[model samples]
Target: MHPAGPAAKVIATLWWVLLGGATAIFLFVAGLIAWAWYGPSGERDEWGYVIGLGLVFPLIVLAALLAYGLVVGERLLPRPGPDVVRVQAEARQWAWRFGYDDAPDRETENVLHIPAGRPVDVAITTADVIHAFWVPRLAGKLDAVPGRVNVLRIEADRPGRYEGLGSEFNGPGYRDHRFSVIAHDAASWDRFLQGDAP
Candidate 1:
């Protein structure tokens, strides 16, 4: 239900699947324990249970989950694409400075603009202490450390305004550190890039 973009959809699906898998494993183990304790005690295959159920089951389940999670994570990475938009997000003090690749001189404070229905790669960095860039409705969170740039891929399915924030506790003013992302239509985005729209 929180799926606003492709990456967000993938992440939400992974979360649900992981929760389902965890619930299934819990119930299975609980039922098995109940059966073993309440049922009639006979000659049990100690080695078989130990090897097959304990070791093999956990290994197989963990391996499958790991593989699935890695695949999902790889899919969410910022891949090279022709239509991908690039922007710079620099965190300092309690504000976000956004610079568009299309416009070198143009800069916005605490507000980011992008074209809707297109992949946007945000190169995040910090000028001062460590902070985090998080836009829950668009994509996942990534830390912004000094001297390091971490790129995050985000997209919006439609034209709207999405809220973003600095998730790390860099200082006392971090509580009010917030931003907004304005996803514009194709024409509006073009106008905005040409210094027509704000």
Candidate 2:
């Protein structure tokens, strides 16, 4: 799947980095095991190699990964901007409701409309049980807890439709708790804002 925006792109990058690192370590360990089991037992001092690779390497990699994750997470936080679009996302039972701050009375269920190439901040909360709003191609999952608002920033690189869902199971209808994000171009997005589209 294509990553629709910067946050997803960063997450995708980190995923690949983690995967590659883990694969490399696995292969190295496997090779060491094979050598120890099959090769001739010689008086070789390889304790340093084992300790360095098994302990020091993982420690360094984990620290670097943590730092990178924090940096990316900070970038994903919602920032006040003149051009930023704000929307309210409410979860209850097994449905999602989206409301635009610009048009208080206008609301959409299970479908969110946003402008492409612009930052959109979604203030997420739950009316009942806890849930998680997740759009893999757009951004990471953010928990929606009762009495708490969690804001997440999402953007589309281009005009398209992306899939979203309630990642946390709350009730029997949780399996159907899916949503779609429709990203429109500047002109079409303006028309949507003008209440010209349903």
Candidate 3:
């Protein structure tokens, strides 16, 4: 049988690999921020914004998550279950067709509809050359190979429209291979499933 959970190991591995570098950069900037602001009290005024974020926002979030991870341990991982929305994204010559279980009649072309705050599981495979599905605001993109299906777990906390781009340069018009993601509230999601425009 497959792993019992949402393959948290894979997600965590990917997260650290991608964010580790960014975290280092953030820490370096944060240190500069502190030195500029509080090191002298005769602080570097130009770093005012960075210092503020270092003290309160970025570090705070990192701490909170660290604490949670330490406390909850394995429970912090996402579990595989029915509630996880599964999306099958198929890429053709130049467009994306997103198929969701709730929308069986017709695939949403060029638009991905997801319910905000819920876990979205995507099993992506390309019909042709390699392609990558990337939505920076929500989650990192994974490669979609012709014969292999890659699974991605994504969660969008806010309800809004976000942009997704195809990172792999398959051929011509690669730049134009982009789509939009629409995150909706529960009620709006229901309406959308019922064929209502959201």
Q: Comparing candidate 1 with candidate 3, which one achieves the higher TM-score?
A: 1
lDDT for each candidate structure: 0.90, 0.89, 0.74
Q: Residues 159-196, candidate 1: write the lDDT tens digits.
A: 99999999989879898999999999999999999999
Q: What ranking emerges by TM-score with the best candidate at the front?
A: 1, 2, 3
Q: Model 2 residue 56 lDDT?
A: 78
- Residue 102 of model 2 has an lDDT of 77
Best by lDDT: 1
Candidate 1 residue 99 Cα shift, in angstroms, is 0.2
Global CA lDDT of candidate 2, please? 0.89
Model 2 bad stretches (over 4 Å): none
**Over the stretch 1-198, how does candidate 3's per-residue lDDT look in tens digits?**
111123334445546644764576587777875666567664345556556755556676667656655555454344698788888898766888898876887478889999887889877888888888877667656888999988777777768887889988999999999999898989899888888874
TM-score of each: 0.93, 0.92, 0.62
Off by over 4 Å in 1: none
Q: After superposition, how far is residue 9 of candidate 3 from its true place, in Å?
A: 16
Considering TM-score, which of the candidate structures 1 and 2 is the better prediction for this target? 1
For candidate 3, the lDDT comes to 0.74
Q: For model 1, state the Cα shift of residue 2 in Å.
A: 1.0
lDDT of residue 25 for candidate 1: 67
Pick out the ten consecutive residues of candidate 1 with the lowest summed lDDT: 53-62
For model 2, how does the per-residue alpha-carbon lDDT over 25-142 read when each residue is reduced to its tens digit?
Answer: 6777787778878878878667975787666777777788788878877877789999999999999887899999877778999999999999999999999999999999999999
Candidates 1 and 3 compared by lDDT, better number: 1
